[model samples]
Target: MSQIDVATKSPIRQRTQGLRSRIEAFVRTFEWTWTSAVLFSMALLFFLLISAVVMPSFWMYYAEQKIGWAGPTDLQAFLEKPFGTSITNPLSLEGYKQVRDAIAMGLTTG
Candidate 1:
C-alpha cells in the first residue's frame, strides 16, 4: 500500500509541474499581446462613440454662431429649398401625397 501511494504521488507531482510550466510559457508568449489588443480596440470604439455624440453638436453650434441672429430664418430657408423640389411643396396636399408615396416606396425597397 505504501509503495503504491509513493508511486502515485510522484506521477501526480510530475503532471502538475508539467501543467504549470506549459501555462507559464503560454502566459509569457501571448498574455500581454492579446490583452493590449483588446484594450486598444475598446478605447478606439469609445473614442468613436464619444466623437459621434460630440462632433454633430459642435458643428450645429458653430453653424448657429456663424449665422448669428438670422440663424433661424437661414435654417428655415435651407430646409424649405430641399423640400420644395425633393419632397413636397409647402402649399399643396397633392405634393404631400407624392412625398408620402415616395417615402413608402423607399422604405419598402430598402
Candidate 2:
C-alpha cells in the first residue's frame, strides 16, 4: 500500500471538495428575504415540534418494551414521566439528570 501525502488528494477527497464548493456557492448566492426567513423559521419550528413529540414517545415505548414491563399505558402518562422508563436505560433524560446531580454532588461535597 502507498502512503497518501498532504499534496496528493484522493478522488473521494476531490469529489467531496467539489460538493462543498458547490454548497458554499449556493449558500453565498441565496436570496435571504423576509418571507424566506419566516418560512425557514417555521420549517425549523415544525421539525423541532415533530421530533420533540415523536422521539420521546418512541424512546419511552422502546425502553418499556426492552425492560419487559408495562410502563406508561398512555401518552399523557409517558409525558408526565418521560424518563421513568430510563432508569435502566442510561441514554435518556433521567440518566442525564442523574449524571448532572452526581457531578454537582461531588463538586459541592469536595
Candidate 3:
C-alpha cells in the first residue's frame, strides 16, 4: 500500500479538495446552451455598464453635492479630482487635509 494517507493531508488541502469537489458537482448540473451563453453575456454587459458608467456618474453627483457646486465648472472640478485621486482627495471637499493627516500617522501593522 502507498504510504500517503488521505487523513494525513493538511486541513487547508482537505478543505480545498472538498470545495473543488462541491464546485464540480454544482457545475455538472448546468446545461451549457446558446441561451446560457447569451444570458451570461447580457449579465456581463449589464455589470460593465453599471460599474463603468452608472457608478462613476453617481460618484460625480455625490462629489458635486459635497463640493457644493452646480455649474458648468462642476465637471472640470470633478475631472480634476476624480473618485480615485488619493486618500485625501476622497471627495475633494477641502483637498490635501486628509492626506496630510494620514501621512502624519503611520499605517497600522494589521
Candidate 4:
C-alpha cells in the first residue's frame, strides 16, 4: 500500500485500539471492586421491597381463608386482633396518657 493509504488507516486502527484499551480498563476496575456483601445487600433490599409491596395482598388472602369470604374487607378487624397488639410500640408516659384519653373517649361515645 502507499504511504497515504497507511496514513489513512492509522487513525482508524488507533481509534479501535484505544476503544479496546478503555473497555479492558473498565472491566478490570469493576472486577477489582465487586463484592459479595454489596450484591447480597442489593438482593436483600429488592426482596424486602417486593415483600412489603405484596404484604397487603397476602394479608387479605389469609383473612379470606380464615373467614371463608373473599373481596375487599375491613382492615380494622385484622388490626384489632390479639396479635395486632403484639406489634404495638411500647408507650412512654405521655404517649400512654394520650392513648388512655383516646380510649376513654372511644368507650364513652360508642
Candidate 5:
C-alpha cells in the first residue's frame, strides 16, 4: 500500500526494526579504539578467570597422583585409619584396585 498504516506493518518487523535501531545507536556512541580496548580487557580477564579455576584444579589433581600412597604414611592419611587402628568392617580392596586402574587411565592415583 502507498499509504502507511499502523495495522499494516507486521508486529515482528516493527519489533525487529526497533531493536536494530537501538543497537546501531549504541554502537555509534563508541569509537573503534574504545571498543577494541574493552574487548581486549574482557578477553584478558576471561583468560585469567579460566586459568584461576583450572590451574589450581590441575595442580591438585597432579599432586594427588604424583604424591600417591607409596609409603604407609600417605596410605594412612588416605584411608583415614592408622595401621594399628582396628575396625569391624575393613575397607574393600576393590576400591583400592579401582583407584589403581584409574591411575593407569590418567585419573588421580590417590
Candidate 6:
C-alpha cells in the first residue's frame, strides 16, 4: 500500500491503472481491414518514393555506360576541331540568315 501510494503522483494515473491487460482489450476492438489498408498504403508510398527519387540516377548511370560513353578519338576530335589551322570557313546556309549571309559572302542564294 505504501509503495503503490508512492508510485503515482498524479490523480490521472490512479484512475486508469494503465489498462495493463492488452490481450483482452485488443481482441475486443481490433479492425483488420483498416490495419491492412494502412500497411498497404505505407508499402505503396515507399515503392513510389524509391522509384521516383532513386531510380533516375541508376538509369542515367546505365545510359551513360551504354550509349553516351565517349571514346578517346571522339573526345580528341572534339578538342582538335577548335584547334586546327585558320581555315576561313563561313556559316552554312540552312538557316534563317541564309539569304543575308549569302549576300554578305557575295554568293548567290539561288
Off-target runs (Cα >4 Å) in candidate 5 are 1-32, 69-110
Tell me the tens digit of each residue's lDDT in model 1 across 60-81.
4544456332122233444455
Error of 3 at 32 (Å): 2.8
Give the winner by lDDT: 3 or 6: 3
| After superposition, candidate 6 runs with Cα above 4 Å error | 1-32, 69-110
Query: Please, what are the lDDT tens digits per residue for candidate 2 over residues 1-110?
Result: 33566348777886798799999999999999999999999999888776666655564455456644433234454455556444566334444444444443454343
Pairs of residues at least 3 apart in sequence or in different chains that clash in candidate 3: none
Kindly give the number of clashing pairs for every candidate.
Answer: 0, 0, 0, 0, 0, 0
Off by over 4 Å in 2: 1-7, 65-67, 72-110
lDDT of 3 by residue, 1-110 (tens): 24476667877887798799999998989787999999999999998777666665664555456745333334455566756457754555333333333332322211
Lowest summed lDDT across 10 adjacent residues in model 5 is found at: 69-78
lDDT of each: 0.55, 0.60, 0.58, 0.55, 0.57, 0.49
Q: Which candidate is the best by lDDT?
A: 2
**Candidate 2 clash pair list:** none
What's the lDDT of the predicted structure labeled candidate 3? 0.58
- 1 versus 5: better lDDT goes to: 5
Q: How accurate is candidate 6 locally (lDDT)?
A: 0.49
For model 1, the local distance difference test gives 0.55
TM-score of 2: 0.49
Deviation in angstroms for 40 in model 2?
1.0
Candidate 2 vs 4: which has more lDDT:
2
RMSD of 1: 17.4
Q: Judge candidate 6 at residue 95 and give its lDDT.
A: 25
- Flag regions of model 3 displaced more than 4 Å: 1-8, 25-31, 67-110
Which ranges in model 4 have alpha carbons more than 4 Å from their true place?
1-33, 73-110
